[model samples]
Target: MDWNERYSEPGFTYGTEPNEFVAAVAGRIPPGRILSLAEGEGRNAVYLASRGYQVTGVDGSEVGLRKAQELAAERGVAITTIHADLSTFEIEAEQWDGIIASYCHLPSAIRAPLFRAAVRGLKTGGVFVLEAFSKEQLNYGTGGPQSPDMLMALDELKLELAGLDFVHAVTVERDVREGSKHTGLASVVQLFAVKR
Candidate 1:
């Protein structure tokens, strides 16, 4: 399925509101240069921008980026957006103070490399925050890549992010209500780490 086409809907697929898990931890992130990965429709990026963070949003879809721009304008904040596929997009090393990966989905094959790139892109002591559906999300029938290999697991995250300093790592089933696309009891992993 063309994920980009799916995002072309008139309404926000993930909703206009930012992820609650993301919001809960946003306050902890000190203000600075921030990069938001796979920031479809720009909800989280715009929120971060509003909070006085210099935000840059990167995503694969032009349609999503357009919506993100609209969201930023709606919120009276400016955000820099880059259109590129995460699979190959290189995150600039030592450039970002924080990296936000909210619901960025990919098969394990692709995720490992992209995540590594994201980590390396952070400056020393840079914060990396992520929230993604766990393997158990299949039971929720909410929103997420359906393929098992595409879903995340605690063990997988532990290994993938082993080099980072983890401040919080947990896999839990929780209420997730965002755009129309993601709503219901979802199994997810929430991580807050700092680059060593």
Candidate 2:
């Protein structure tokens, strides 16, 4: 299904709350500008902005970003939204203090270079946070891509983010309640890395 089509519907696709892991670890993040990858509907970016972090949300769908902008406005927080494909989106080297990728899955060819870009985008001491469906998630059928190639593994993520120090990396089975699409038990790989 087209992402724009899905996002154009009424209400937020992923609901208004940030990811569970993101909310849990928000305190550990350093105060600075943050970039949220594939930040559909701006939930995470708006949350970060509410906490005084300068936030930018990038997504491929203009419709989704429009909703993000609306959400930001409703919450009285500011979030810059960018409409671009992750496969080609580029960020200046060391341009960001923090980078977040929540459920932004892609095929290996596209995901690899995007990860490289993410590493380069982080400044020294910058944090890189990620949460994505694991290959095992196909069995759960809660949400996320069905193909295994679109899913992530811990070791693979480590290699992709080799430029950063691994603060935390694990694959776990957890309950994900994000709107109607992403709800129920899910297998996911979560990462928290820092550039040094």
Candidate 3:
């Protein structure tokens, strides 16, 4: 998918509000630095920043990152933005108090290592939150990667992020109306885990 092209459109692709799951669980993360993966348009990052968490958003699309910064400024919240591919972006060990991956879909080859890195990147007692379209999403015709390889599975995620203690983990079909793109009933996996 050409994310740069998609983000270049007139408005925020995923809207300006934080993800519902993220908003619900934001308090679980200790106050400190947070790293947001695939943080397109800065919605989640800006929300966390507004809640007093230092936030850094990373995305492969420079255009998206630019809009993220603009949104942050517009929201009167400061959020750092990084333009880099998730597959190659380094997650420093024990550096983040929280790491979030909302709708960040990538092939397993890239996602597996990235998830492992996320596990190592969190400080002890830190939280890691994720919400992604499940493999079953193809049946819903909702927003998500069409490729099955890019969709996630709950059991697979548990294995990938093994060291953390799961606070919440489940697969559910629910209505998701985030923006112009993500709207409809969707199958998704949500995870909230804390580093031991």
Name the TM-score of candidate 3.
0.99
Model 3 gets an lDDT of 0.95
lDDT of 1: 0.88
Top candidate when judged by TM-score against the true structure? 3
Each model's lDDT comes to 0.88, 0.90, 0.95
lDDT by residue (1-196, candidate 3, tens digit) is: 8999999999998999999999999998999999999998899999999999999999999999999999989989999999999989999999999999999999999999999999999999999999999999999998899999999998889988999999999999989999899999999999999999
Q: Tell me which residue pairs clash in candidate 3.
A: none
Stretches of model 1 off by over 4 angstroms after superposition: none
TM per candidate comes to 0.96, 0.98, 0.99
Task: Report the lDDT tens digits of candidate 1 across residue range 55-123.
Answer: 999999999999999989988999999999888888888899999989988878888988888788888
Task: Specify the poorest-scoring 10-residue window by lDDT in model 2.
Answer: 21-30
- Ranked by lDDT, the better of candidates 2 and 3 is 3
Model 3 misplaced stretches (Cα beyond 4 Å): none
By the lDDT metric, which is better: model 1 or model 3?
3
